[model samples]
Target: MVIFGVVQIIFSQIPDLHEVWWLSIVAAVMSFSYSSIGLGLGIGKAVEKHADYGSLKGVGIRDVFHDADKTWSVFQALGNIAFAYSFSMVLIEIQDTIKSPPAENKTMKKATTIGVAVTTLFYLSVGCVGYAAFGDNAPGNLLTGFGFYNPFWLVDIANICIVIHLVGAYQVFSQPLFAFVEEWCSSKWRNSNFINKQYTVKLPGYGPLELTLFRLLWRTCFVIFTTLVSMILPFFNDIMGILGALAFFPLTVYFPIQMYIVQHKVKPWSRKWLILHLLSTVCFIVSLAALVGSVAGVVARLQQNYKPFKTTY
Candidate 1:
């Protein structure tokens, strides 16, 4: 989306105000989506799960194979590998970006604050301008959508942006899982394959014939799986949200509460945290129900007919 905006800003013939608006909406949505994965839900639960499972060292090959076996197919296994690699890459990038500056100098603190504030204001301006120009015609994507309705040139620019944005998103999203596998491989291998991974911001290198072989086969499958899905379901944003909500939402909310309950067993807990835990669990349950209910609502909405605003000859 950021890439889309940058390209649109550079190439779109839409009024400056209108271009800004569409870009703003896409940016806001992307920010929220990425943030939610990293902080809002998944990260917390993953930490607790790892701790409970006794870190990577405590797990065995059978455990890995057993888990892998449960995958829907060989393709799904590959998808999981690629997904992990992608997730790790993103996490590492974010960690590096966030960490390097803080450790380097005291001036970074002030600079960071100013940078964030300016970015926020810029996004707000875009949103306001987009709403003013498109009104109800505004779609989630400025270039792809606006071009469809108004000007083909605007969409052409948007398509370019979307391609770049997809690459960036893939680069970031794959980091978390990639880093985990890389670290695990490093522990087992003394070779430069693992060392070379430090330079590139993509998937990390592998070692240990067993682990490397598994990941190679797995990641290959993942690319194919994701490719098929992307082709079949091109509605990326909403689908991503729904998948995130179900898998991530549960993993985030329930796992932590389980950890806390287990950690504090035989001890009385304070009412505040207890209440918070209860509320968290309830929210998850409600969200699950709402998601299920939405399917029916979508079907009903789709089945409804809309009147054409004009007559054709």
Candidate 2:
């Protein structure tokens, strides 16, 4: 997110902000895999060590495969693949945004800081308005609140950012899935873990056709998906608002707070736990309302879009 912030700062100053957005997306795609793969793999390892089904505690290697299969199924339904891929890209862009310029470039550093500060102020201002209007149950993106406030121009700007943010999130989420697939397939085929499999280039005559076919199919599917999304762009804000509150909000805000509270073993007297516990509680409530409220907002939007007219003349 810091990287994206930095990119946003630089790109905002540039005349071609759209180009910058694309560049940021590309950078995110490249970095997502490396940044997030550890998280899923770590979970898999933990599960392998634990979650013994009593009799299966000292079983063969088949336990690992069985657990992996279960995990993969859950991952598919949770839409983690898309989310991880997108978040990865956004994370890199945000990092770039927040990073300090080279020491020698003092002028650029100062300017960058000023730029980020201003951008942060803008974000904060929107957040304030959003929170005031919707209280703790504000949508994940402030733009939805802007729309509720009946600001058309802000809505348009929010739409643009929403697209960029979604693309980045998709890249972030996809990383773990790609990593899991690569690891699982390699391990299963080679009878060894993925990292241990030495790279081999013994290409048979069928290799070119297979590679070409895969590329063609992937690209075709992507195009179709893009078209479908474009067709549904009108309601993208509402969809994202609900999803952000339900999935992203819980994972990013609530889970971390709860995790830290548990990790630190906070007692009733511990200020840290008390604060975090309160925060988690508040966030939990807010998330619930945000999920429900965002749905209401969507329904209202649909009504406004397709309202029934009455003749008064």
TM-score for each predicted model, relative to the true structure: 0.43, 0.40
lDDT of 2 at 178: 36
**Which ten-residue region of model 1 has the weakest summed lDDT?**
10-19
> What C-alpha root-mean-square deviation, in Å, does candidate 1 show against the real structure?
18.8
RMSD, candidate 2, Å? 20.5
Worst 10 residues of 2 by lDDT: 206-215
Writing each residue's lDDT as its tens digit, candidate 1 over 1-313 gives 3333343322222212222334434644555443332221222322343222233233344654345332222222222222212222232234344445346334554655665675555445443444344443333343332433334553454455555445445433443445565567667775655333332122234221222443444444554555555544444333443444455334545655667667767244678567857777775654454344333333333344522222111
lDDT of each: 0.41, 0.44
Q: Pick the candidate with the highest lDDT.
A: 2
Segments in model 2 whose C-alpha atoms lie over 4 Å from true places: 1-22, 25-119, 125-173, 180-230, 303-313
* Total backbone clashes of candidate 1, pairs 3 or more residues apart or in separate chains: 25
What digit string (tens of lDDT, one per residue) describes model 2 on residues 1-313?
Answer: 3343333332222222222455556644433332232222323323443322233222234644444433332323233212222232233333444435454346544655775565455445443444444443344443443443334554464455555654554433443343344456556666543334333333454232112222233334543554454344344445555665666545656666776667777786588767877777876665565556556555655565443222110
